[model samples]
Target: MVSRQAGLLLAALVALAGVSVVGGEVVDAPPTLTVENDGDTTYRVTAYTVESVEDALLTNFRVTTPAGENRLVTYSQLVWPAGYRNVTVTDSVPSQQVTVPPNEAVETEIRVWEPGDVTIYIIEEPDDETHVWSDMKACTERQQEHSIRLRDGYEGGGSTCASDLDLLFR
Candidate 1:
């Protein structure tokens, strides 16, 4: 039979080993970007902002590659709010466009080696007739306040109605 003192010593050693093992590795929190649709209609997300550590502003929708380098590639797609779709964006990588349904939310996991900021842009579709709720400025203001709404149409003569949501990474 094992003595009480021996058992206690073994337990303490195991605990110390566990701590040392964990201390030897560097762990970082996973970065995530989420967009929630609290409006009544669905909106298509066309672009998002990626601010690099060097303060370079980049857009995920349209990226121009450097000379002699591969074209900046961006994958855009649609996603349902409550589904098992696995969407991940690596560090310095652009995520695919995701259409967020009404009353639902979509998120992308961003893996960055350095700290930066991410801004999501929601472009409102143009309508034949002007709409009260389709104002891009209003929509942007609402988004900044964390209140998401449907962007059916814009009153102005612009081709697209775009809004942005900024997020920071440490």
Candidate 2:
């Protein structure tokens, strides 16, 4: 009887693991990273994943250069909770600012100059005064990594870049 009970408990756990509901959408619950090529030959990336109740949302992103130094990137907005905004970029190569919405899914770009396999990170704190660190409930429970590229386009002797951002839902 003990063995049978253990089997039933394990089956229940497995069933729970397979169930996922985000924003009322039936999902498999995999962590995902999104990348976009914005106008002006810049790239924008936003990482979204599941989070524990204890985590906060004042997050940041980082891109590492071939030189081994990390360049902090900025965002124009946050998608969750609906109206948080960003004002400046710190430790970022091409400094920029953004306006974030609260608790919703968003992918706004702040800066991008080159193209390569980039490692994007979601930081736990805001970089400057204008931007508040992601709140504790805004944190992700599982960790994920992603790579993005920014391409340059030229038309009529002028340069025009566009963002073809990709959204991943897991």
Candidate 3:
């Protein structure tokens, strides 16, 4: 005959096993894409995946304005895990371009079900032509290194533009 303590221990072990089986594996949170504007001029930031993979998943595209407003850019859906989505600045007066005013910031967050890379473009539309101010590539392996802050007409993290300017000014 088993002791009462042994019976309770066995019941606890069985319960833990059941719970583990029911819960399965825990999923990781999707990666994030953040863009900060610290320059005097306004900009429109856009992000999109580079290449679409067959087994990859992309969903929950959200765009947050500088004024603390949250808006849904895309519905929760699966798409080829590669391609660029022009992130519209929701706070701008003109709807055609999402504008980030001076000293303001914007962010685009999406749920990435697969591992891939993305490209973010900082564009300026002064006239009919759209000029690309800066662009940075982001991947899962380098997600933390991807946050870009545009300050004094230069993007952070040792961008080539900064180097070029340094050489030109010297």
Using lDDT as the measure, the top candidate is 3
Clashing residue pairs, candidate 3? Answer: 48-84, 48-85, 49-83, 51-82, 52-82, 89-98
**Which 10 successive residues of model 3 have the least lDDT summed?**
75-84
Off by over 4 Å in 1: 1-23, 46-93, 111-170
Model 2: lDDT of residue 57: 29
Displacement of residue 94 (Cα, Å) in model 3 is: 22
Worst 10 residues of 1 by lDDT: 134-143
Descending-TM-score candidate ranking: 3, 1, 2
Most TM-score-accurate candidate: 3
Model 2 RMSD vs true structure: 16.0
Candidate-wise lDDT, in order: 0.35, 0.30, 0.41
TM-score of each: 0.33, 0.23, 0.40
42-131 per-residue lDDT for model 3 (tens digits):
666444443332211232344343344545443222121122233343321111224576888765543432334443344543332233
Answer with 2 or 3, whichever has the higher TM-score.
3
What tens-digit string does per-residue lDDT give for candidate 1 at 22-51? 454423222343556666666554333345
- lDDT-superior candidate, 1 or 3: 3
